[model samples]
Target: MVVAAVLASGLLLAGPALRRRYPVAWWLLCGFPVVAFRVVHTWRPLMAGCGLAVSRRPALTVVSGLVGKGAPPPQPRVPRRGLIRPTAGGFVLLVRLLPGQVPEHFVKAAPAMAENWQVHAVRVTSWKPGIVRIVASAADPLTDPRIPKQRGPGHLLRVTVGALETGAAWVVDLRRIPHWLIVGATRSGKSTLINALVAGLAPQAVALVGIDCKGGMELSLYEPRLSALATNREQAVRLLAALVDLTLDRMTLCRVARVRNIWGLADKERPVPVVVIVDEIAELFLVASRSEKDEAHAAGTALIRLAQLGAALGVFLVVAGQRVGSDLGPGVTALRAQLGGRVCHRVADPGTAEMALGDLNPDALKAAQAIAPEQAGTAVLASGDGWERARSHLITEAEAEAVAAEYAHLTPVLSELHVEAL
Candidate 1:
């Protein structure tokens, strides 16, 4: 009984402190007391209220002492205010909807609003609980954090999709899993997100290679940091060849060391993981002629190999493209299987959205389609454990750029893949 009292007291004191420190955790922890109350109510009617009252008193007391009652309560969210007046000179305008509004209304109204407002962007922010925000450029200075230049490369990379809601962000420890599939429509912030990832990894002590199919326009920005970049059909194939060879070499290294997971070894002794980012995957598979079948087959096979075996060898792939369809080529389904870490942004069609999120829950697929175009940076991320959750946080281009710039300084030296020539 004495120990129980001590633990209760500690919990009362430390619980609020922990909630304050980790707001996201607070969301999860808030349910505990309610659940306890429910469970206790079934057995001992009076204990539910009594326990809640007792537990809350101490927590409230600590919180009250920390921030006196005179202090204003923290605001959950601020009004969407801007430097320019809502009706004033050119600026981004967004329309938000309250819960239970019709989604069709927003879908129908989006184009007209874009035209009438002369807005560059108009998107539905939410559905079910409907809200919309439209962005228009201002004549004055740009205050948007999504702008790439302000935050630089470091800011753009590795955004916690739940940051705005949770108020805490994390650099998803990718070492735990080996590959990710990044799918979004054109200009749906796919390339910008990739830029952010490269920038995030640039400074890390890891090997980086890129296959830019759009004539290297996307990945070329960080030539200063990239160890290897492949631009066309030939180059992309060659790059994949080199990566496969490198994966084999790493496997041999791991075999000799008698280690499985790299994390099992000491940090200094572990091999540096190689991360390969492929932009515009269609280029590798969309071959026009039968004569090119051999090359396409080789490229597709190499990609599958990387996805299946790369994680064990400490090699990872981040595959991004406008659309991921079986129509794109034969190996699409095979590659998708290996990419367990999946993130889907707003897409042009239900089919594309289905392609990205179909394997998961039916409700999640509905949520993916219902995603408002205005929520471009918003995505649904699923981990490798088969547990999936939807996240509705906006990742601005500027935020990504900022992340990229930060890690650009510590860019690691490029090392050759110790394998036979292709």
Candidate 2:
């Protein structure tokens, strides 16, 4: 008995440390069963308490048909529950909602469910008709997300940057959704995310073109792997125009090959894919004087054209900026519509977050707005599918620079894009 007591006390003392070191193990061995039991035990009452339970009674059965001799009214019917499945960071269950109950009902009750389950958050998503999937995380996955190992070969135009709130990998698949708009304030991990993205793409056989109008302050680190680098607004304009010309050339190639897009062409005949990284996009749009207005307009038109036709012509855009608002120009709004993928980090103003996610998902806008300054890499990303909180893995400038240098030999020489020579 004394030995058992000593062992129990030791485990009690080491519980937190073990949980911190091995969260998945601790959750599976210690937390899952308890949480599972709580979910099953309280589900009925919890549903009824949240007003999700529906009464089963006929309108004609008033006053129980007897003052004191009638049987007690039947309890409300709760939603049917499915098997509770455990995940790496949490658990998921399916619920067949009662009649008149929509997925929105469950979504509205997610906070209550989380509170009762003593979990960090609960997400309710429509799994099928009349069925909703509830995913509950025991803790915040973004606190210290584990980075997945780099594999030998990855899918083309796809990079796994970090982990999502659902504990799944946060991937940016440029092929699936070509253009991206990344907006974040200074030190909010905007640059870090770009570094991770570029580092992931560095080893791939893709032509990287950079237009950093900040005089090569940020993107110059990847100069080794880039086919073209434009530093000033003047050079950016020339480089963008050159890219437009290159796309037109590719379009002609596709037309002659009888292919719809570049991807449909034979691999041997396909031109190397081009990824344009535009850092500080506001620099290309903001006009200082009347003389620069036409220059800004030209830059904006070039970007809009790229965003319109780049995805089909083997050119993709990753546009990042500290601040992006409609007040910048109507061109900003037009460009925003073309970029389907948005990652909004902690922004200095609500307008940036709105510009990034408002049209896509209002809830995502709220989530992005809630990102604290301390949560640097944490962002709210939204596409046509939905929105979720995610964090990008940290990739320092030196690491990105090294990766660029390591893949310098793979850089495709596109003579047409040599803006410096032009």
Candidate 3:
């Protein structure tokens, strides 16, 4: 009895701490009692409170033959049927909708549900027939602290970038979405996200190319693994021209062989795949003087062409910047539109998030803009269907450099792949 009392007191003291430090796990652990209260109406204080919250209405007493003044009328409870399953950063509820209700109704009531559950937010997705999935969460997912790595390239040019809010590992297949645009403010773990990506690809047989407009201060660190590096506008222009030429060569080969894409050919006959990583993409498009405008236009044209035609030719792009706005240059808007994959981290302004994900989903724009500085590496990732809150694994610069150096031999030469047809 003494030990039980001590343990109870300790748990009572830890309640606030756990909710603040590890909300996701704590809520999941407490789910059993919460669910029980929803069903059984247990007598314990916590259980009783949860039961009251889920109940349709509270019993009212007649005072002076009338209801008490200032006593608000009870509201009907939402008819819910589901079980909670703990996920990586949250919990998923395989819920069944009530008659005349659709998933959109639940989506509209998500905020109210979040308030009742005391979670940060919730996302509603249709699971099947009459089933809906409610993903609820509080804490950041990157707190998992697991170092990110890929087993091997899968069905497509797949790479693991982070974990989705549903607690599942999220992979981005470049074959499906060939061009990606990543936006984040400084110190928002944008560099770490890039490092995780580079590390994931180090063991694969692919060419890693770079364009660092930051005077090579960034991409230069992985020089040992990069097949080509560009530090300035002049270098970027030349490198881009070469990439375009290679894409043209592959295009011709595909047409001549009557194959739709390079991947349709046998491995030995296929050209080497290339992944171009660009740091501070806006710098490559911005021109200060009339003397540089012509060069900038050409460089921009090359990048747009690569994004449009590279998906089938085995050329992929990962372009990142502190902020990407239409005012950057003449072709900036066009280039942004072509990038099918969008990752927005904690940005300095709502406008940056707007520019990144607004066209895809306006709701995603709000989610991306709301990311706090403390949640670095946590981003709003948007694709064709929808967006999800995800957290990228933290990989340090040194670790990325080491991985690059270890697999430097796997890097492919563009010239070898750009051979003239026999």
Candidate 4:
């Protein structure tokens, strides 16, 4: 008995350290069963308490009493619950909503459910018609996310940059979503995300083109792997025009080959993919003179064109900036529409968050705006599917530069995109 008591006390003392260091293991071993039992035990009362239960008709009760003497009255029907499944950091269950109950009802009740379950938070999402998925995390996974290192060359154009709020890897697949807009203020992890992305793409066969209008200060680190780099608005306009011509060339090749997209062509015949990384996009639109204005117009038009046709022609865009608002011009808005994927970190202005996620999901905009200034790299990303909170992995400039140098030999040279000549 003494030995057992000592062991129990030791485990009690070590519980928090274990939870902090190995969250997934601790959750599975100690958290899941208790939460699962709570879910099952309190389900009926919880649903009724949340006003999700539908009461039986009083007239039916009377009729039943008369027809079958002393029969019990029917009880309110609660939504059917599915088996609770455990995730790395959470538990998920499906609820077949009662008649007149929508997912919104569950969403509205999520806070209360979390309070009762003693979990960090609960999210309700529509799984399908008449069914809602309730996911409850035992603790916030984003406080310190652990991302596994890449073992080998990852899938083409897909990079696991960080961890999502759900404790899943946050993957940025350029092919799945062709273009992206990443907005964050200084030291808000905007530059860090770009570093992570470029580092991931460095070893791939794809060509990396950079238009860092801030005199190439940010992108020059990867010069070893970059096929082209533009330092100023004038050079950016010329480089973008060259990219448009390159896309047209690919389009003509596809036409001649009778293929709708470059991917449809034979691997040997397909052109190498091009990924354009535009830093400080506001610089491209912020003009003070007629020449700069013309240059800005030209740059924006080229970008819009690229965003429209880039996906099909094996070209992708990752446009990042500190501030992007409609005030920049109508072109900024137009470009935002085409860039289906958006990642908004902590910003100085509400307009940037609105512009990033307003059209897709208002809830996402609120979440983005709620990002604390101290939460570097924490962002709310939205696409056609939905939105979620994520944080990019920290890849310092030196690491990214080393990755670029390691794969410099794989850089594909495109003479037409040579900005040095321009």
Predicted candidate 4 versus true structure: per-residue lDDT over 115-186, tens digit per residue? 999999898889999999888888877888889898666899999899988889999999999999999999
- Ranking of models by TM-score: 2, 4, 3, 1
lDDT of 2 by residue, 236-349 (tens): 999999998999999999999999999999889999999999999999989989857888899999999999999999999999999999989999999999999999999999
Candidate RMSDs in Å, in order, are 17.1, 2.6, 6.3, 2.9
lDDT, candidate 1, residue 82? 22
lDDT of 4 at 135: 86
lDDT of 1 by residue, 288-362 (tens): 788577677878899999998887777788998878888877698889878877777777767766666787545
Model 1 local distance difference test score? 0.58
Local distance difference test, each candidate:
0.58, 0.92, 0.76, 0.92
Candidate 1 global TM-score = 0.59
Query: Candidate 2 vs candidate 4: which has greater TM-score?
Result: 2
Q: Indicate whether candidate 1 or candidate 4 has the larger lDDT.
A: 4
lDDT score for residue 250 of model 2: 93
Candidate 2 lDDT: 0.92
| lDDT per residue (tens digit) for residues 1-422 in model 3 | 99988866876788788866766556665543464344323222332333322333435443322454755554434445566566645566666765566777667767666666656667888888777887876544556634345666544457787787766677777777888999999999788788877777767777888889789898877888888888888878888888998899999999998999998998889987899999998788788898688888988899999999998999999999998887787587888888999999998877778888999988898888788888878898998878988888877778878887888888876653221310
Best by TM-score: 2
Candidate 2: stretches off by over 4 Å: 1-18, 58-62, 65-70
